[model samples]
Target: MNRRFVSKVLCLASVSTLVIGTMTGCGSSESKATSIAQIKDELVASTGAMAAESVFSRGVYVNYAKDAENPDKTYFYVFNGDGTGSIEDGAADTSNYFEYKIGKKDVTFYIGSIDPIEEKFTVKSSEDGYVYGSFEDGLELVFEPVSDVEVDSFNATNYVNEQNGHDFVYHDANGWSVKYDPEVITVNAGGPMTTFVYTAESAGTNMITATYTVDKNAEESIKELGKALGDKAFYTEGIFPGTEDVKGYWVVLNPEEGTSGGYVTAMARDYMEGALIFEMDGHFGEDEENNMLVSDTLAGIVDSLTFETK
Candidate 1:
């Protein structure tokens, strides 16, 4: 059987924003402990001419609503200044405009619409080291440090279309040839990396598997790389071509043990360009022909990998 080898690479991009606003009364002093009006005046004086602009700066953006037609909910937005913002909900969209002001230092803006005249547009600034926001029904919005910010890139390495001459087809040791095509290829982009998944089927067996690749140089440590693969098995054999020294891992997944199933093997390798990973999965029963077919297919594909180390 012809061993089909597939490689997938997931890239992630980092997005960061620096905020440079001073808290109203960060210094401990009896005179600094004043009313809200005094705090606002101090902030205005410090801003000078820019006080009139009232512009807010952030690295991300978010929006919230119960429904599109009648948005009764409110949401917070963080703008990254790159024309890209993160929405809290996967279903909500962002507005084209953002607002802020110098007088509202250490303050968060809340956006909501209550009525024609009493729209929920207000800013709650900090005073005496305390920040506060007004909310309906005694609801309060608190500010906290952003946690675990991550961005991902597109996965374009594992291209296995038959018309492109990259289809997986191989011959087995028993002289039985088997070939199959993947059902779908999906790319998930997040945090520091990306993931590509390919689903394929066998002709006679109900088994299916996927082949993938990754960049080893992108990760800071092997343990981190292993964590990124997330709940998958590892292996030392069946590595990509020119990546003999790289480590490998995999996970044996079987919903019904002792019936008919397969396992997933993943390998992490270092390429001159970056870290490269490959995954091969198989599912079969006690049929010797099917088992040998899958084994040979995996071996052939691993042997044919070529790394462009730079």
Candidate 2:
């Protein structure tokens, strides 16, 4: 019932984080991590004093574990500067506190005689203060600075309590967030540029039929794209309102397949000095309702989006 209109603006996002001293690495099954001493050597050279404070000092960490008391569940915790830490056990809808320290890449709880109720890390420092330690089993883990922004998982179910309200909600790994109705759209599938793929109930809907990408080469790419699109795409600087400076505009796209009964449109948004880019396409039936849905609905969605860029 809805004709198709391609979303034009593709707002990209770019963001970029923490943890631990050590004991023996966690269970033998986990990843075998580089010793803490080695990590320190590599970290200190470029980072200098900032990284001198071991990841063990303070921060939040996320990890998974399975044992007698705790099944293989993921845990998120904040290790305070005072040596005390609080952990969240979502299964129980509860949280607990403990004392912790890293012997190397290993974290021990309570005291010397106590086995590490926590786990260990196979330490790898991608940047200065940024540390990624995979548990021996290779589950992904992150140590986030306490001051970093956070968001509920973008895929959180019941995204909108109202059945007819926006159905899909997303927070990119970096905490940028957005919501949309799933009955009409899909998300990013594979990736190089497009981080999300979306679809609607239009006959023109074809997998890979539409595209979206977050271009790290944003500025050059956008400038190149603007030149290519020529007069068809114009800039409306400061498109994002109430924030720094956000601007975007629409392009009346050409028809796809036969002009039987539909139209396509493309919208692109440039932000974070083009470091973060987002582009979306929409399809609408030949009806005004679908047309309105395509334009108004998407404009509102883009206006409400919130994210941080590095």
Top-scoring candidate (TM-score): 2
- TM-score (C-alpha) between model 1 and the true structure: 0.27
Write the residue-wise lDDT of candidate 2 on 156-191 in tens digits: 133212332534554455335565556655666334
lDDT of 1 by residue, 1-310 (tens): 1111011001101100111123334644443334334544544444422322233344322222222454422243444544233324222222223232233323223333322122232334322222234334334443222323322211111111232445433322222122333433333434433333343334332322222224334233344545555555332333334345654443333323664565554455444355444445456566668566655655555555444332
Which residues of candidate 1, in runs, are more than 4 Å off? 1-240, 243-260
Kindly provide the TM-score of model 2 when superposed on the true structure, using C-alpha atoms.
0.39
Whole-structure CA lDDT of model 1? 0.36
Please list the Cα RMSD from the true structure of every candidate, rounded to 1 decimal place: 23.0, 21.7
Q: Give the CA lDDT, 0 to 100, for residue 169 in model 1.
A: 35
TM-scores, in order shown?
0.27, 0.39
